[model samples]
Target: MPDAPPSAAPVEESTEDWRRRNVGRLLNEAVRRFESRVLERLAEQGFHGVRLAHVGVTRNLDVAGTRPTELAYRASMTKQAMGELIGQCVDLGLVRREPDPADGRAKIVRFTDQGLHFLEHFRRAVVAAQGEMGENLGEERVRALLETLWDYVHPDGT
Candidate 1:
């Protein structure tokens, strides 16, 4: 009979250390890496200065123009932050601020033609990046992984 391979030594870790480094922490790190990879891919596809967060505004604008307050609520960002980002977008000619019909004092943010074009490009980039990732993980595993992750994030439908 062949001899069994030498047994590996058990590495001991403290309960506090293990708890301190749990799945939530690991998942957060993984998400950062995943977003970085996706954003890098997006830049290669002509979205030079865009990041993942831009998706929220672009999509929201595509659906319908919204006030800064509404966008902040939807995106879970501060109104000031949304305003600043909208200002930067306006400077880039991606979006515009137009007078709100209901409230003359309020301006709604709308996506420009260029912004729509960029949104389409962003969708394609995301698809391409996800395709690459799915290829690495395989379709079946990717589907299962997505389902598991979704379940973890939201017990019911989200």
Candidate 2:
């Protein structure tokens, strides 16, 4: 006679359990949705040629300009990858490489006039996105969520 298989136990899915299981996935989906919305808004505002991959570099760009190495580190990408993105941005007239005043041998990436215009659109889109998120999540929950994300990103409070 064949042995009977053990019966599986029923598991109750509580809210906390569900959240624990899905938070990371939800976070990634939220980011993708937010980025898509922002890009859509930018396109409506007349910005073009900006891809999702470019955000990895642009989001970490320094307002005063920064060295490629520093930007790469900030973006957690290799220098070669950053260089390629910078080259693309340069070709798009979004950025330019200028000789670093502090180091003659080095170059710093600075935004072109067009890039600054694009940045303005990006800023407005982000603000609109945040407002939408607040409306959907409620102000208090959005605030708490921002605080939690900040703490998670800066665990040492630096």
Candidate 2 wrong stretches, greater than 4 Å: 1-20
* lDDT (Cα, tens digit) per residue for candidate 2, span 24-103: 65689889999998988888987677877676667777878989999999988899999999998888777899999999
Instruction: Flag regions of model 1 displaced more than 4 Å.
Output: 1-21, 59-62
lDDT of 1 at 132: 73
Best by lDDT: 2
Q: What are the RMSD figures for all models against the true structure? A: 6.4, 8.1
At residue 131, what lDDT does model 1 achieve?
Answer: 75
In order of listing, the candidates' clash counts read 0, 0
User: Lowest summed-lDDT stretch of 10 residues in model 1?
Assistant: 3-12
Model 1 clashing residue pairs (backbone): none
**Candidate 1, position 63, lDDT:** 43
lDDT of 1 at 103: 97
Clash count, candidate 2: 0
